[model samples]
Target: MSHPDPWRTATLGNGYAASVCVTPDGDTVLWLLAHGGCIEVDDDYGCCCTDCAPHEQLNRPIPHTMRSALDRPIQPRCSRPRSDGQPCRTPVARDGLACHWHRTTKETAR
Candidate 1:
């Protein structure tokens, strides 16, 4: 079976639209604005923007406004711990919790 796409597109009203996707780091979501810039939102709902105007307007609570688009499941990241002892940020392989490199190491350990 095919996995559901993680990207979502939403209309932001006033003729503006955005394509939203989770960042590879898995800690932030990126909003690619129609106006040729982007915004990055963290789990705490804090945001940074490439354009000041849109940032001023769309900087409010994002979950309420983009509920439908943000409701989809987030892609799972690799579970292996890194040197800093944090979980790896890489996306997991289709059938496993570890990313490619970590998955190989796991298999070799068996």
Candidate 2:
């Protein structure tokens, strides 16, 4: 089997790591190190949209040191089954202090 890359590779440690799931509308939910975890922004203006389109965007990725995987809010899209078929809480806290998973973007004016 092949190994999955944990990092999203937006800008090294300063960019969105994962491009979770995109809304039918346009909002992008990217995994960042800052903003605590998840970061919501214009779909056409974030680096976490590599899986989106190869268009020039605005926001990039913040510095890893300045990024945080906490204080964001996230919602669970699906659930998983355990060995006994028990469902466990797969918290995808995007912007809450509880879960440490959020998407981030860098500035384009830079």
Candidate 3:
């Protein structure tokens, strides 16, 4: 028997977002976390990453559209493994939380 894959949560401007694997190896997340999550194959496939694994996990596609300079808390605070068969690297975003393998975005790092 199989178990529900381990999951992780990311805090967004609205609330919490959860991400889980569906295919166990399909290279993308199943979009089980939040309502606005990107599920379309094309929309969810690309990574705004360097060390990100070939597999694409659903990322919070929402961008900070603030008209003024504001701060936001990072998500995940680290990368979690997916149910997908192969391995992947932790995600690193500009303003988001620090994952196991990524660095703070240069803008904020200063």
Q: Which stretches of candidate 1 lie over 4 Å from their true place?
A: 1-65, 93-96, 106-110
Poorly placed runs, candidate 3 (over 4 Å): 1-6, 16-20, 24-32, 36-110
Report lDDT (CA) for all predictions. Answer: 0.51, 0.37, 0.37
Q: lDDT per residue, candidate 3, 9-79, as tens digits?
A: 44455543444444435454533333344322323443223233322324543334442224555433333
**Looking at model 3, which ten-residue stretch has the lowest summed lDDT?**
48-57
Output the number of the TM-score-best candidate. 1
**Cα-based RMSD of the predictions, in order?**
16.3, 22.0, 18.4
TM-score of each: 0.34, 0.18, 0.19
**lDDT (C-alpha) at residue 67 in model 3:** 20
Please give the range of 10 consecutive residues that has the lowest summed lDDT in model 1.
1-10
Give the TM-score ranking, best first: 1, 3, 2
